[model samples]
Target: MHEKNAGQNKGERHLMMQGKLNRGPIEFKSRPAERTGAIMAISTTNVVCVPPTMSICDGVSTMTREGFRRLPITDAGSGQLRGIITVSDIVDFMGGGDRYNLVKNKHQGNFLSAINESLRSIMTEQVMTLRENDDIEDAIDLIVNKRHGGAPIIDDESGVVGMVTEHDLLKALFQGQSLLSVEDVMSGSPRVTNPDCSIAAVAQQMNKYHFRRLPVVSDDVLFGIVTATDIMKYIGSGEVFRKIQSGDVSEVTALPIRSIMTGSLQTTTPEKSINDIAREMVQKRIGAFPVTEDARLIGMITEFDLVRTLASR
Candidate 1:
């Protein structure tokens, strides 16, 4: 088993280092890289924005199709940042359904009618906004504490500039080499397991693979994520087992992963940036994020990964 594990580790490392080594001076540039007085030199031109009066249904649809979890809402005429929308907001609206059902038959008791009416009346003004020059940490705080997934970036002139999301923070932390998409550093194949796996077995897998966390999958669908923190939290809580004696059953041995795993999960995609990932970790007070591709678990990014990447540089 030890030899097998060693072989696996070697293979994984080889796969990771397969790319060519480029020799050059690495340049590090961040949004508001160097604060220039009250006016920050924020990257704004490439921001994606939509009209404030647009239907929420349409906005949700667009985000889902584009694999974006957040988008900025802007004024159509003045192009001013109004607010932002997120996957959480849409998920809350849909009540955790796989797909939002907006249409319904008349016999369904005004389901479609209500949805239509709501869409017609709903607008982006109801959400919040942040200034472009505002510290990125401030945005992180708002998103984590307020449960917002995205915020519209605005200039001192109150015009819409760009948008920021949790994934953006992940990108910043893991892939700091360029302003490229988050997908660049995101892992395309992640290790996953079922919640029903035995604690000992799971521990063995983690030790064997050197994984900090594993995405919990059910029927090939992502349910949530379980991390080393979760395991430690469980042990620390002492709700499972207090003490063990010789010939006695350890409390942890009898526990199931689902009993202690965190149900509320925050995730990201491959298209985010490393700086964004780092910002997210600081803001959300989380140590890691499960990276996904098309809603499928692919890889994970953690504080350790960021530290290792930085050390390598």
Candidate 2:
């Protein structure tokens, strides 16, 4: 055992046999160049939120008015998290078969009333949230793996402050790619949507790949497309996605993917500059531009993919 004393030099006791009591100069190798590039903790303190008591219609309207995709549902008084509501959740409910059947049967009034329900009724009560001081990498991992658009950042009191999103992550890489082109970073082969396919099928595919949207393709022709937003728009009709999640593959459950898929699409070409594409995505608040070749869909360049590529460096 080594004798211990703060005043004693390190290894002094071992060197005592040599009768050298004085301390020698310490030789230190260049301490690994102050390792950097570690991600700092991210916060979500400035995120928009809604009260659970608010009607789904109101919440949805708020999301639209504020250009938000999701909102944290909080207690009115306590300001504590109660649940979360996304455009997707609302669309899932609205696009359900029962709701569509009602609309088809000349019962538009009943369909209208359904959307007036409280956010608490439709909001996901079990929300996955990040603390104000959570490591950004952790948030990125959770968001990417779980396919979340973004998550609420909660304060010490559990109140939402802001969000940490793919947009923020991608912003960090704008400087990293000085001359990379869309073709260089784009996914050469992307999962596409088939018009004849069921919405359920497409949704499952989206879930499987954590895709935000899919390019609609049929007979090697690129048509419109389906986005997570497009799906959310119909959620107020029916909870079709939920049924699809529960393993219901019947036709009634296999709602037409074409019905909800967005008809107008924004596309890019292989020769387009990556910086130009990034600017467009950021300005439009959209994820990617389907990379097309000779007016045919060839690939995609999404924020998720962009971030992944940059982070790898």
Candidate 3:
């Protein structure tokens, strides 16, 4: 997610490192006019959290079922925020290894044997949470900087309050973009997959295209969809990284996507108002929603696409 924000205009004096967007040796100062007044946006008290005792698998299920990209872990009895599990953490952990031994070991053993591991195994213990009184601008900056998609908001006595997300900010900005139908802004004939496609292969495409999700299709029929977050949940909790490390490539990559896809889909229409679509996306916290008409899947509207539209406008 370290990609460019949809609305950033690299005015001048901005130098980008080759391709990897991690800021390089460039430094500078800014004037008072640079501030966009992005603070104090989110102030909701509704949030969803997972218990520490829940299995990582079940936790993954909860997030996908509820349409969340990250889940804050809390003490079941104390209701205190513990930590968080995110797609970045999952991908980072799965992507590491001292190239030689890591790759060598993975090719010879069953890397996926550890899929049922506990949540504590992969969850980040040192979490940076919002204090409710904290400025939402800071969260916005972090998101723009590609640190996280969302931040968990906390309350007095260390209880969970709510979460502020990049999508929420995008929702506010997209309402002003030139009026257009969903089809006007959406990517039609999107890349799709089937129920039997291997998760490993699908994951590669997602990483390559920086896509969050892909619609699942079979025999020219759309049934459901899979996402990067969903893949992280599967590989992280299931200890599939262990398989990747153990060199059991064949076994780990054999698992079908149907085991993880969200079968029940929420769809939009080609003629639907983009305003209504944005509101629904913000409310649901889902990045990609299929656009259908007359019961046929035709297009996809993603948060990235929305952000790009806002940028163009």
Candidate 4:
């Protein structure tokens, strides 16, 4: 994917590397002087991968069942890394972006047939990977600058050995000791969606803004939360298949987000300490928390925000 800009001028290449190809200018933060052990200690070893032959529906099922945001694809016989599929990619395939052509054109508007397509149809062929020799700071710099949430860790001979993500980095940085408060790192007035919004709209917003999750609100009160994973689960778990008879992608995406939103929320306060929030995140296995004030949505404290705090510190 990085090679796509090889023909571009130096200045344009810089923008591409800085993750400005489609989004706004990125604010690169942090070069944690942390040791290499920091990343390896937190990375998920014995990484799970799906074969390229796996159906798209089964691929999503694997991710949902495993609580993973991304899944690596490997050659079934050689075990060599082939590609990767993330929640974002699934959203794009589900009608969020141009990738929906696989359904509209390739499958003749049949959502069911489109989903049954092999992961190869939607998987990212050229994945950005982390070599085993790379250090924690190197991982941070690469992932942040690329605007990727996580990456598969590759070894020269063994192929994929582990996986690391912004969430993992954040957990390693602060463990209930930092003095920074949530307000210091939390992004205020997070982009929100409503329950009545269609899955297509939510997916569009997520793709456009590069948001993995959006708080679902009604008349300024936080009602629930919707995430890319949730949408994937809706399909992977057979809920969407059961709800639609026509098997058209629009028939599924046209449904309100409320159909898949998570109403139960684990919230935080702006005045809360980052360390405490970190502890809560680890305990709850949650990546981001909604910051509320007087029972109203105020802001959001995410793994990236906390990771930024660690970088600045």
lDDT of the candidates, in the order given: 0.52, 0.61, 0.60, 0.78
Candidate 3 vs. truth: CA RMSD? 11.3
* Residue 238 alpha-carbon offset, candidate 1, angstroms: 1.7
lDDT of 1 by residue, 1-313 (tens): 0112244421122111111223344444543332132212333346666776666545655554554546677667887666665543343232222122332222132222423333323333566767756775565456555755556666777786666654454443344445534344445456666777655445555555545467777655677876654554443344433433331223344456676686588888765766677777767767678776566665677654554343233
- Kindly provide the TM-score of model 2 when superposed on the true structure, using C-alpha atoms: 0.65
Q: How many residue pairs collide in each prediction? A: 25, 26, 9, 0
Per-residue alpha-carbon lDDT of model 2 for 135-219, expressed as tens digits?
6566667766776667777778987777777786666554433345667677766666567767656655555455567777765
Candidate 3 backbone collisions, by pair: 106-245, 106-246, 106-247, 107-247, 111-242, 111-243, 112-243, 115-238, 115-239
Worst 10 residues of 4 by lDDT: 11-20
RMSD of each candidate relative to the true structure: 16.5, 19.1, 11.3, 9.2
Q: Judging by TM-score against the true structure, name the best candidate.
A: 4
In model 2, which range of ten residues has the least summed lDDT? 11-20
- For residues 1-313, write the lDDT of model 4, one tens digit per residue: 1222456321111111111113233243434445555356778886789999999999999998888999999989888899999999988887778778899899998999998899998899899888777787767786666778999988775478889998788777774355567776778756677788888888887887778898877766778778898888998888988888988888999998888876478888777878789878877778899888777777788888877667555
> What value of lDDT does candidate 4 attain over all alpha carbons?
0.78
> The CA-based lDDT of model 2 is what?
0.61
Query: What is the alpha-carbon lDDT of model 1 when measured against the actual structure?
Result: 0.52
Residues 1-313 of candidate 3 have per-residue lDDT tens digits of 1123355322101111121122233222212112244334543446688877676556666775666678888888999888887654443333322221232253333444333445566677777766766664565555655545677777778888888776865665654524566776778656666778776666555555556677876655667878777666665355555445444645565678787664368888777767678777788777878887666677788776665555333
* Candidate with the greatest lDDT versus the true structure: 4
Candidate 3: deviation at residue 137, Å?
A: 8.1
The all-Cα superposition gives candidate 2 an RMSD in Å to the true structure of 19.1
